[model samples]
Target: MQTIVIAGGGVAGLELATRLGRDLGRRNKARIVLVDSAPTHFWKPLLHSVAAGTIDPSHYHVDLARQAIDNHFEFLCGEVVDIDRAGRTLKIRARLPHALGHESVLRYDRLVLSFGSVTNFFGVPGAETHCLSLDGVEQAEAFRRRFLRLCAATSGGAPRVNIVIVGAGPTGVELAADLRHTVDTLVRYRLNSLESPCQVRITIIERGPRLLPTLAPALSEAAARKLRELGIEIRTNTAVSAVTAEHVTTADGEVFPAAIAVWAAGVQGPAINTRLGIALNRNKQVLVDEQLRAVDDPFIHAMGDCSAMQVSDSTAMVPPSAQAARQQAIFLHRLLAGIERAAIPVFRYRDQGTLVSLGEYGAVGMLRQVIGDRYLNVQGAMAKAAYRVGYERYVMANLGPVRMFAQMLVRWARSRWLMPVKWH
Candidate 1:
């Protein structure tokens, strides 16, 4: 029997592992193995909510070991240090906890590379050390702690708390709105005894001309208007030169100091890709062909944020997104399902629109592909409902519809009955 090893536990890797584990491993035709640095999985899109205390990660973290057992696969907790393509073996440096239980090298018949991406500080001075980011649970929880401490310190005498978010992309925009909502909710609950009201100000600085620049101009305008209505500041065409514990200096010699800084500027593939000797794009992402195989190596397959793929017979390229990852996972799974890789069909990417949640202020989305080149924009309640369902659908993929719906109801009840935002 052949062996398949997937390295990553993000959306693409996890889904593929679960399906292949059951489909291939159950029949005893092949063995499926999932290797990840962490023992659990969390949706990258919700990191902002976690940072803002809008949601608890407990509801989203999926245990890889438990899934592996139930799905008939093996789970390894370690980091892939080196890959000997010719030898068909990988050097996995186990984490401290896994060192006692796992081996250092794993053999594989086929390899799938989906390690995912990381935060790109853009070589900005002090940006990495000074600013907070929402890259993982630890980072998000760190931001939340800083946020709580800032609130506690400034509840009365600090006048106001200023938070500077660099980047007007979805993460930055959504974080701003979530923070605004968190402050209001905290005030309403009267948790801080430092006066009747505490103000928390959010300022999003964008080098681009507007927020959500990749989206339609109309949607961008709507998002900007909604954010402004919430008293969140928007600074367009502003480039940050440096960051310090006290301030962020721009190219124009202007400095915004005395603010909590968050660097959501952009993302690039993990630096380890360069060491892999694989063909990579400018962003350090592995460049894959239509079949989702690395351009330079046929045996290596890549997906998720760390990979960029060009579709066959079309000028379109698949962007790194949750939807694209899901499509890629399904496509890859089908190719490996009782079919030879050489006879696998070409993978085609479908644009499945985009939905952005604006905390409690509302939401905005664009329906594309299904509507052709032109898109129909939806906002407010309708967009919010769509955004809510988008997550539910991802949950359905992992937890199944029945359990996902039940979890949704539990979350809804918790939000309504317990508290809208968590303080700790």
Candidate 2:
């Protein structure tokens, strides 16, 4: 049996592994192996909520090892440091903490790269050292701990806590709004005895002309209005030059005091991509063809945020979004499962629209029509319900309907007694 090795057990990687494992591994046709640095898998989109202290991450994370056992695949906990295309092997480095690391080589008949992108600091002085990012679980947990501490200290009669988010994308916008709701929840449920509510201010600085620039103008306006209504400040067309412990300085000499600074501005491919010796785009992402195979080597494939491919008939490349990643994974799975034999169809991305959550303030976004390119703008209660259903669908797909409902019931029960935020 031939071996298939997938690197980075993220959204695309995990899904593809599960599907291929069930189809090929169980049938004894192929050996499926998944490689990732993290022991468990958490949905990347929810990292912002983790940072905001709104939802418990434990409810949704999937154990990669257990999933591998159930799905007839093997899980390896390590980072893919480099790939030897000529040798058909991968160099993986152990990711054990506080210990000497070791490297190992794994051979494979075919390879798939799904390692996600990392936060791009753009060489801004002090930006990397001072600003926090929600790129992974560890970073989100660190931010949440620090945020709770800051709020606690402020409740003890210190100055107000000011959080500055240096981006207007979905992560920054959702995080700002969620932080506002979290502060209110903390005061109402946990710190009600204090004389005053926790004084927390949120400011979003966008270098673009408006927030959510990727979305339609109407949707962007709706999101901006909702954020402002929730008491979040919005500053557009502002370029940050430096970030210090005390403040964020823009190019125009304006400084904003910040107790916590978050950099959600942008993302780029991981540095490891350079070691692959493959053709990379400006963002360091592997350049692939429409079939999601590397232009350099057909045996090596790439997907998710780490790869870039142009649309079938359009000039735009596939955007690095959850939907795009999921689509690519499904596409690859079907192709590998022998669903397409003679002429393999090229991958075409269909925009299902964009949705931004604002915690208790509700949600806003645009939904693409099934028939045509028309998009219907959504807001308030309907949009909020849709936003929630979207996550529930993802959970169901990941954990199966039965397990998903069981977890939901357990979470609901915990909510009856547990506090809204993680205070510790």
| Candidate number with greatest TM-score | 2
User: Clash pairs of candidate 1?
Assistant: none
Query: Could you estimate the TM-score for every candidate?
Result: 0.94, 0.95
In candidate 2, which residue pairs get closer than 3 Å at backbone N, Cα or C atoms, i.e. clash?
none
Candidate 2 lDDT tens digits, 1-424: 8889999898889989988998899999899999999989999998998998888888778999999998889998888888899999998897767422788999998899999999989999999999999989999999999998787776456677889999999999999988887888877776532234437889999999999997888889988998888778999999999999989999999999999999999888999999888999989999999889999999888999999999877888898888899899888888877775648567878888888888878888888888989988899999898887777777676667898889879988888889877666
Error of 2 at 98 (Å): 12
lDDT of 1 at 55: 94
| Model 2 Cα shift for residue 47 (angstroms) | 0.6
Off by over 4 Å in 1: 96-103, 193-198, 311-317, 338-344, 369-373
